[model samples]
Target: MLFYNKNILIVGLGLMGASLGQALIKRRQSKDDFKVLGYARKQQTVDIALDNCIIDQGSSDLESMAKQADIIVLCVPMLSIESSLQAIKPFLKDQVILTDVGSVKDEVIRASKKVFGNMPNYFVPGHPIAGAEKSGVMAANSELYDCHQVILTPDIYTDKIALNTIESIWKFVGAHVVEMNVEHHDHVLAATSHLPHLLAFSLVNTLNHRSENREIFHYAAGGFRDFTRIAASETTMWHDIFKCNKDALLEVLNSFTADLDILKEAISSNDEQTIKSVLSEAKTAREYFTEVLQARSNK
Candidate 1:
């Protein structure tokens, strides 16, 4: 639970998994205790991870790696969670604490219950709000999650001991861990994280389709570039997250669409007062959120 003297198995050695391996190695924990083993579908990735010292040992084989782990952290995409869970279930040891880093949780929790045969006590659902526009092993950094928020979704069947132990693990990785239920976690992330990614992708696509001068995009500034930066994140990962949390994301998307429609109508009608009012409100809202974030950081 403390990750001390425990074999921590990380599946899918992408950015998150590789970064986790590095963080564990940098910690006071032993390489054997937090022995970061993994299994990538690519043998090249397996070799690269071992060569880079990002992992103790890894292979293209899941069953072999799963058997030797004390804790199995599923770091693949949300859509892959179910299949990964199924594939590794046959090899899972009863004493292992199984967890995931999926963006969406309701479907994952349900699928996990079935895969683990309704023993939700052994499962821990987590989502670390730290990543990059770039993915894969090459983009990993040991400090990717430094001071980042890691949300843990614990439900009725969730064991307190298991949840607390995982919290300790995230803390060791320098994450500020917080607890929330599945629905609350999904809904909040839908607005704060998922919706932004969705909008970023949409905004970038809209620009691509517009009849703008060829040099318009070339003249983008820091703010413009930063706004759309995350649009470059793994498409398959975001696509899977959107699908898993479809209903909640759709609800937020609908509300966002209605607001955009209102803004569009005001623009066409030359409603300068309406536009100013909206922009002023947006500025105030941003400032308020910024202050809150700053306060948390100072704490």
Candidate 2:
């Protein structure tokens, strides 16, 4: 109902944007259902989305699409957020609600502030904590966000109606919506998502350069393959995230390095007690995390 008769424009027709369009199309219930529009930098990407019915309509032209959207969701890379904002600013309707699905909210907030001279009341900074290792329009799945968590970071200037509109749309797509401040959102994602991706990329790179690299890969077990799976994610997108969120990521990285050093010392000194203590704590924490995830899925 929140999207009734609305023109929902997705400003970047990549995995996240295309997935959102697919989900919206799947949720259509009647003739009054909202329209889904998509925009990508390339006409080919737009054509692919249109051909696949991922979006009702799409184009490579941002200005034309921007003028028609009642709700605009920017799904571009972190580095392009400001540029995208600038491109669409002139055409945005006064009633349009703007949002984003970027991983780093602090950077998004800064970009929005810089573009608008302050964060607009109708602009909501959001992050959908869901994705696939694969990227691009072809990889988009209608259920990618099903039962997933979508975090919205709204500041003091955010309009309640605009925030509720974003929340309603995400919930309609099967995501569990939650709210957090920009700083807290960035910090939490740094420790959980960003750090893991960094470690995965680093581990894969390290193994790939080893003398026994081929043998290492050839003999990779289930755990090794599973842990490194995220290394196959889109490099450019992750690169932008790392650049935009360096401060928070570095904070978490420092903490992780300190722990890693302690573990290294324990292993080097052959301290059985210390080794067991660290491993035990990690195992227990992992179990608790698993429990929490399972519980949320059950909900």
Candidate 3:
């Protein structure tokens, strides 16, 4: 395994961090072979991580624990990325690999480099493109990234050696990895990932306040469950995503609003053919996406 000889320091032992630890352990990554450390704000969280075997050791100090790591994976909230990066900037070892699980990659890349000057070739901005609707270390599991997509946004400055090693790390955990630019990642994700999450949150909020809650609750089925499923995901992570990708997300949101208005007009006009054709096209499009998704899964 790629992590076999590396010491990994996971900053913030939250859901993503703990899940990564479990995944590494399930893959038979030994504690001595690859030291896994966790940095959490709470002593209780540190104890929990140790009890769950998510990490070999836990500490609340970044610089102290970070000095012993070969790779540092920042799994904190987006708003905290810059500050955390700065905190560890002064003491980062040369050639030490760095990565993050943040949804917003462009800003993360910029801030990371700004705080830590002369980054080594191993600093790659990565997102697993996978998570659960649960938060915290207690809810973490090892199979979170099984057959999932891990997107790496490697810019010109990204060290080729570093990117390849990062890719290997994800591959060892059963993730199919792909490379893309930071801007394209932000734009495309705003449509496919970010927008859907935003809509899910809005839909659940709208339904929760309705007068006929009993009726809505009674009819919650596959569609409702699927729609609201991601809505239950970690709000802090999603909130940071929206806030950090504000400009890109807002642009896409505007386009979506325009499309929704067109559908609203068609529905209001009682245009049966328009509604039928629209729904049919959507179903067809979703089928294409499913086919692509299945192809990736089979790999």
For each of the candidates, the C-alpha root-mean-square deviation to the true structure, in angstroms, is: 1.7, 0.9, 1.8
The residue-by-residue lDDT of candidate 2 on 149-268, one tens digit each, is: 999998887899899999999998999999999889999999999999999999999999999987899899997897789899898899999998999999999999999999999999
Q: Which residues of candidate 2, in runs, are more than 4 Å off?
A: none
**Candidate 3 residue pairs in clash (backbone atoms < 3 Å):** none
Clashes of each: 0, 0, 0
Query: Which is the winner by TM-score between candidate 2 and candidate 3?
Result: 2
Residue pairs clashing in model 1 are: none
Best model number under lDDT: 2
**lDDT tens digits, residue span 1-299, model 1:** 46677778899889998888778778754545557788899999988888887888898999999999878889999888889999988887878888889899887887876776674687899999999978998887889878899999987878777787788888888899998988999999999889999988987788778788456589888866976797899988999989989999999999999999999999999999989999999999999999989987886
Weakest ten-residue segment in model 2 by summed lDDT:
24-33
Tens digits of per-residue lDDT, candidate 3, 1-299, equal: 56567878899988889988878767863456677888898888888998998888888877788888878889899889899888877777777888988899977976766776654457888999888877899987888888988999877877877788788878877788999888999998999899999999999889999999668978898988988887988877888999989989999999999988988999999989988888999999999999998897677
lDDT of 2: 0.92
- lDDT for each of the candidates? 0.86, 0.92, 0.85
Instruction: State every prediction's TM-score relative to the real structure.
Output: 0.94, 0.98, 0.94
Residue 51 lDDT in candidate 3: 93
Question: What TM-score number comes out for model 1?
Answer: 0.94
- Candidate 3's C-alpha lDDT? 0.85
